[model samples]
Target: MGLRVQVDNLMEHHSQKSLFAVVLGEMQDGGLPHIGCRCPRCVSGRVGYAACLAIVDVRGAETAVYLLDATPDIKYQLNPLAEWLGPHPQRPNRFNPPTAVFLTHAHMGHIGGLPQLGPEAMAVDGLPVYASAELVALLQETRLWSPMVQGLALRLFSPNQPIPLAPDLTLTPIPVPHRDELGTGTFAFLINGPGKSLLYLPDIDSWQAWDAAHSVLQTVDVALVDGSFYSLAELNGRPPVAHPLISDTLAFFAGWPGELVFTHFNHTNPALEPNSGAVATIQQVGAKLAHPGMRFLLD
Candidate 1:
């Protein structure tokens, strides 16, 4: 059945698990069911949360959990991992915050959930947040984000430098071209687990624009790249969108051996529907659409 269900089944069957990454969301920044749009997909209630991922390692006595991109739907996204997080040691009837959070960029969908970690919600103390130097400065120096920053330990990392999460687990941020506002750059995380590696690239302009697209993607065991729009028709009369179409992406990566799973879909994307022809085309090529709750074991 769906990858999400498969993940849940796998989690239940495993008494002890290894390093893995879970698909917390698969939709674009705004997520599905756009604010005022009455599109078929939005009305169908088949929409999903914005792009987010959770990396979990249960090999240790206490499960270690980290999140990639703090999306707007952080609350619901974090709920499924409550068992792994355990309970807050100081607070009763509350879950402990994730070990850390790594942001891909300063985009709203990527960092909007930081407020939830402030006084109003989790009120986490000393929670580690890894981001680019510019992003770290923007958040720490901005008055609006001061409250949240006070509770977080911001770590500024340069692109291409690997941040070791564990002895064997490392994450390297690779600069990628995207719609960058506020002068903060964008990144696609390359997660190197003990045995396997996956690239979590939710947003990008065009694959051709990237110099190392082929070299980086081909080296990973799994590549979850952007599939924001399936075709130009989805834009209607609007100017051409920034993201690469699914057709173009498929053709661009033709014959690449790594497994491809498309994520960060727009609301109007027909591939969001399981029975759509777009899905058939993608599946025919051995690639699949990302679904919430989907998990990929590193080993």
Candidate 2:
């Protein structure tokens, strides 16, 4: 099986998760889901607040595509993954193995993609979407989302529980602390293949809150940590809420004992400037930035 991720664009984070997109696979249909669409610099795409990250089949054959964080750009993100996978609007409602959808959290950018499961898009008869219990509850409690789930037949699973995704793939949910406004319960994912592994953490309030006393840190091939804001110093205009910035995140990785990469950035974060002096500081710590079009092939 082939696995890779592609970025659509970097977002502008003033209020929400203003970050970028990362594409996992291209579509079998024509170039309808173009990455350049909707970026601040791209006139051809839509204006977006979140970035779309997709995981695709490596050989351009049959494979599963998981949209890491749904993002406000959910339509743009799934447009490609659905078309590429066998679940497009024109395809039959046949379930395929090794296929699954994992949600990182309840935030709009994370779970907004839930609606695409309907007949309007994927026509997924009963697509199993793995999310925390609270997230499923939140969706059920809300108005629009509640109806969406009730109609789509989305399945909820507990965090930290490993579920088989394919004959050779398994996914485990790792809950991370974040602003629990929606009460969906936040999480990072650990996807394990036959011999490869990956950790996906997008929006955590602080690493210190995660598994506080557990050892979930030392066990993965690639750990994508948070990159929301650069530092506490970046909080200039914001009134006070409680959350850690990218600076605090940098501190966590200083001692982390695994291959670590950082993503989910905000405009306030200095790491956006790929060549900026502040980003250079993040690099000095041995942590890396997750940008559009960067792919990691599992060994």
Candidate 3:
């Protein structure tokens, strides 16, 4: 089905007891309209937020929302969840913060929006934020971010261990090979819900670098893997990019059982254009390009 139809179906069942994962943004870390470039996509005023996802559980008396990454576009990203977040206790015309946020790594697009939760903005109190031990230490040691870090209840999570969010929902962090400069490892979250499971792996150096890549992909119902670049030609003579090229990714997962969805696209990626040959190739292979508001039902 088309993405619009899928979104409508999810919204229609919002009141029912269900668990779903929604894409908040699907662009690469820099996001669309990249910093200084005047590329055709950027010059045309096309916009896309950084890669991020939110898991919503409506199975309990109160809905619970959890974020996969706190991107720079978080303010706009959170707008869609306003109805579920409800009103803020003391602030008018505002919504409550998410129940928690899970960080994949320390990239700017992954943890950049944290400043919005500090004293100057949302001023959230005791918000639960989960991340790797090294990442947590890095945030706490950064003097400039002390104000924001103070409000967060930073929790450390181990790789491959399941952290239960509800009786039927659990999130497991699986270490993946990625460019890590701070000695803080990267992760690809494996979310297990009541009826289905999903793997949110927005960034990875290459599928070959991870030993369990194929096995892990086979275990999930849906795999939102990295698609940062369609080809190295988009790099414009820069050094080789770390992410797996879309072409290689397609060949890597050909005939895999689980649904393969590509995301985290760079501004230069031709796949962003609906009619581009890259997109058509992906469609021909039964894979899909993820977009904002794309919903994957887990239960």
TM-scores for candidates 1 onward, in order? 0.96, 0.73, 0.96
Per-residue lDDT tens digits for candidate 1, residues 1-299, read 44346456757855476889989889898987887889887787665789998899998878889999999988878876777888988888899999999999998899999998888888889999999999999998898887677989999888999989889999999999998878889999999998899999998999999998878876699999999999999999899887999999999878988889999999989998889999999999999888876778886
lDDT of each: 0.88, 0.56, 0.90
Least lDDT summed over 10 consecutive residues: which range in candidate 1?
A: 1-10
The backbone clash count of each candidate, in order, is: 0, 22, 0
Model 3 stretches with alpha carbons more than 4 Å out: 1-10
Ordered by lDDT, highest first, the candidates read: 3, 1, 2
Task: Give lDDT for model 2.
Answer: 0.56
Q: Which pairs clash inside model 3?
A: none
The stretch of ten residues in a row with the least summed lDDT in candidate 3 is 1-10
lDDT by residue for model 2 over 174-234, one digit each (tens)? 7778888766777777777665677776667666666642377666777766666666666
What's the C-alpha lDDT at position 57 in model 1?
90
Off by over 4 Å in 1: 1-10
